[model samples]
Target: MSWNRRSLDRPTRRIALAGALFCGLTSAGCIVIDDAEARDEAEEVREDLRDAADDIAESITDALEEIGEHMSDFAEELGGETLVDQPIHFREFYDFLPERAGNLRRTSREGATGGALGFHMSVAEAEYEGRSGAEVEVSIADIGAMPVIGSEGFVEWLDLSVDEESDRGWARTIEYEGYPAMEEFRRTRGDRGRAEFTWFVESRFVVVLDARDVTIDELHELRDAIDTDALADLRDREGR
Candidate 1:
């Protein structure tokens, strides 16, 4: 039987030939093969290949578009990159904690890395004690790029908007250096005693400062001592 392949691409011709051979084999020892039947089978095979290619290309394009939109929304919420590299080592995170800030002496330091409940993180932290029972605790946690599934994780505070106050304390969400932060202030023996300021930095690191018997200004001072620019440079920090 005569076969025409001049109008077809190389792959189409190869597949069409295979289809025709299968059709002939199915005839089961027939003496003569029908030319029209061979042509019809080849055409059908060519159409199926073209349809499959179109479907794959369409699926890929749709997937890419969806991913782009998803990442954009995620970045807007995070105020940084949608996806970063692996988390930095906890030892490296410790280097960001200050040993002393305006007379406060570091009393303790620790670092560790682990995962639980669908999340992984590396943490480094230190505590500083000053005169008059005042103290500051600083910590940095690297949570890597993968968003924690099955739980809100620590970032649940980012989605909050609380502004509550009483005679002795206040808890609210405030803005710090253009970042939405969580801060709480309470009075113990004096006007202002316990304080907490926490924020997510560089889209991957969580910076939290908890203090006791310190004024708000003192908290900000200790915060200013941390090299935030250097901390931000640690974005996408890669490690094991």
Candidate 2:
């Protein structure tokens, strides 16, 4: 009878030990799996952030590139000594074009990317010699609302696009007539052009970039800017 009892106790002890060991291993495995999952999630989030930053950087670079390219092409057509600069500003936003490349005319003081009222720094010749076909025009200003009403209006007024490749959300015509002052009106207005910069938005306002070599009426036919649909789409997707 004693032997039987001992035998039964031994089997019970073994069963208890086996169950405890199994439960402990399962718990440890669960903890390991949880830790691994957390690490993977963190890695994914970091990668996403990096990708977003990269896309933004790329988009900004592309916009600047387009500006530079257009300026270069226009300068080449003028056939004169040209100077270019990246950093330029008026009382409002960053002046995208620092100076008129070939003619060194009045700089367009359009609004900034963040919605601000822009002022024309100076009024001068509309087109450089030999560069008759080049002029930057703003056609739309659809920036969101802001605290200052003037800023919003200015943003809408100065959102000019000369590069056809950037003609996705805005209208920018490049082939506008920049006139030389005719003798018929010399007595009244001296030497000035009838150039116009068409605003293609809800509120149509012609913000004249210069009143010297161009006329407001002649600038009505400025509609040659090309639409860079693919480039613009890529930029939009990148969130620029």
Candidate 3:
């Protein structure tokens, strides 16, 4: 029991002290670094996300502006009386628009790969084509929906008569780079003497007609006589 102070200090005691000190220091250092690094990383991620969001917002705004400008041009062309070739009243629904396109109603569709976006424009003739070759000369750009082409809708007016159930619409041969690229559906009501032609641009469908007191039978004749080739040619010209 009468041992020296130095000899009383056991190896186990020394090792224990060293281990505790090492663990304490290591843990303290780790805690400091982990917290700071975590905070920095979180901040960086937040900044990146914010930047991406801003870019996306800006892009969407730009696209909306562009779409709006195009729609305005289209409306102007369609609104113009010269294009209609008849003194007619127009009913426009442009005010009902998406938030992005300013004042044009734009709709987006989801597809497996991508999606489609579109707008609508409907026009009616004010006067009937008197016994003459009346034409609606819309710019290929307006209806074709080309990126950089004409900015007016085309015109078509005819005074041809055909039998009931007869397929005698206007005939014209036009060329397009990738046509049949689009399709045109025509409907005529012979009794009503009214004809309606529809052109679908991707998702946007434009219905063109000259139905001022038109009979169904007349519509059928006009439907049958829409110049498909002429439309194709108009589209081709836009490419040039």
Which prediction has the highest TM-score against the true structure?
Answer: 1
Residue-level error in angstroms, candidate 1, position 79 = 18
My TM-score estimates for the predictions, one after another, are 0.58, 0.24, 0.25
Query: For model 1, where is the 10-residue window of minimal lDDT?
Result: 1-10
**Which parts of model 2 have CA positions greater than 4 angstroms off?**
1-43, 80-84, 89-240
Instruction: Put the candidates in lDDT order, highest first.
Output: 1, 3, 2
Candidate 3 weakest lDDT stretch, 10 residues: 107-116
Superposition TM-score, candidate 2 onto the true structure = 0.24
The whole-model C-alpha lDDT of candidate 2 against the native structure comes to: 0.28
Candidate 1 lDDT tens digits, 1-240: 001011112322233233344444434333443698886776666666666555544443343233334434543454533244445767886667777788677876755454333234555667788877888867676655435311243245356787989998888877776666778889887765998877666556667787899877778878888777788777756767
lDDT of 3 at 118: 37
To one decimal, what is the Cα RMSD in angstroms of model 1 from the true structure? 25.2
| Error of model 3, residue 11, in angstroms | 78
With a 3 Å backbone cut-off (N, CA, C), the pairs that clash in candidate 1 are none
CA lDDT of 231 in candidate 2? 17
lDDT of every predicted structure (CA atoms): 0.60, 0.28, 0.29
RMSD of every candidate to native, in Å, equals 25.2, 31.5, 31.3
